[model samples]
Target: MDVPEALYLPDGDGFTATALTIGPWDAAHQHAGPPAALLLRAAEQASGIDGGQTVRLAYDILGPVPVGPVQVRTSVLRPGRRVELVEAALSAGNDRPLMRLSAWRMRSRGDAAPATPLTHPAPAGPEESRPERAAFFTTEVAYHRALEWRFAAGTFNGPGPAIAWTRPECALVAGETMTPLQHLLVMTDAASGISATLDWTRATFANVDLSVALHRPPRGEWLGMDAATVHGGTGAAQCNALLFDADGPIGRSSQSLFVEPR
Candidate 1:
């Protein structure tokens, strides 16, 4: 029998984050990536743009979101025929704010916008890449098991810049189909982990914000992040990743980090 995937079990307007949603840093804290995807889900629902494509995804993590039940509320900030802006907020118990997210969705251009050439080609396929070491993450993380990862360059949680391709090991929500946009959101938030510029043993590097800009929606089940991180002496850092599908570059994602010595 296959292991159950670490994803949400929808409960009305809320969802429960399972063991697979655990983060590497804190046992009680959930990973920012999964919540970010959930935020996108709520935003997409509010936008009511079934045929729309996400052009930008922004996430502001206010604090560590405790694992367990959480609720999402979404609203349309700006309505447009060709474009729309939607916002979502994730709250923990007692409706405490944990994260705020915004997305810009636009009608598909189809052929109006000519296809741009790929500046970054697809890296090695998932079969050719290596799995991240088990010891790299101390605390059990849901993403580690929920997703399949293959590194293209550098080392897994090893050091400087690296590239890793990833795909969902199982559904993000039990019995629910996840969209391409949702998959991209989850993987993009891992920019810092994919490439670390700081020592994990001596420092805590957490992303406070995440932003993704896509020229076109990603295609294929496999998505990759060519990532790099930079840390300043002033306890601040940032990670950037060029995202790709199996074909080629699809978009880009970035995160602002909070770096502090342990």
Candidate 2:
């Protein structure tokens, strides 16, 4: 079989990370986006989630995930017909879990009223946006090459809020089709970096956890984020982003950051 030009390749029971999974911070470690998407895929496939839709996905970063073979373990934490909680963890070799995902799934009610229409207007579409490269990256990186980025407002080199749209050029896994949730998860982790308020050379702002809440599922291949980071006086910060698709607003994502001088 031909090699897959994707973020990950399926191995035995787990998947092996490709160079596309590398993040801007470290070439040896995988970006949170790829792993987050992987965990969500596992959670969705786990038993007891067949009839339900995942409304919330929260991830805790235990450590830096190395770019190599990793395994995912998933199980239903709380089982129910209408509501359920599922957990998935990613680990490499004999080391402890690098990341853990807790997802809440809810079954849809046919007789329930329709969802409230979103009034929030979307940012400029991808066609109207300009192509931009992240200034923090000094050398060629696989993660950067794996996705197409366009800016509607602000910039990757600027310090402030930003509105950007992105889509993966490659699949998440070798032979599997990426779902809409998986596509959204793959880009949500970059909200902090895309809207950095601090200089990248002066200090480092790393997210410890990521929480995403979706009122409705996203559609289409492209996803947009109106993102901003707020740094406190203490060694803490938060990155908030409103997620959107080609249609309109779909959800929101937040990240709790750990700030420190480099």
lDDT tens readout by residue for model 1, 18-60: 8777777877888788899889988887876668888999889
RMSD of 2: 2.2
Per-candidate total of colliding backbone pairs: 1, 0
lDDT of 1: 0.82
Residue pairs whose backbone atoms clash in candidate 1: 20-142
**All models: lDDT?**
0.82, 0.87
The TM-score of predicted model 2 comes to 0.94
In terms of lDDT, the poorest run of 10 residues in model 2 is: 137-146
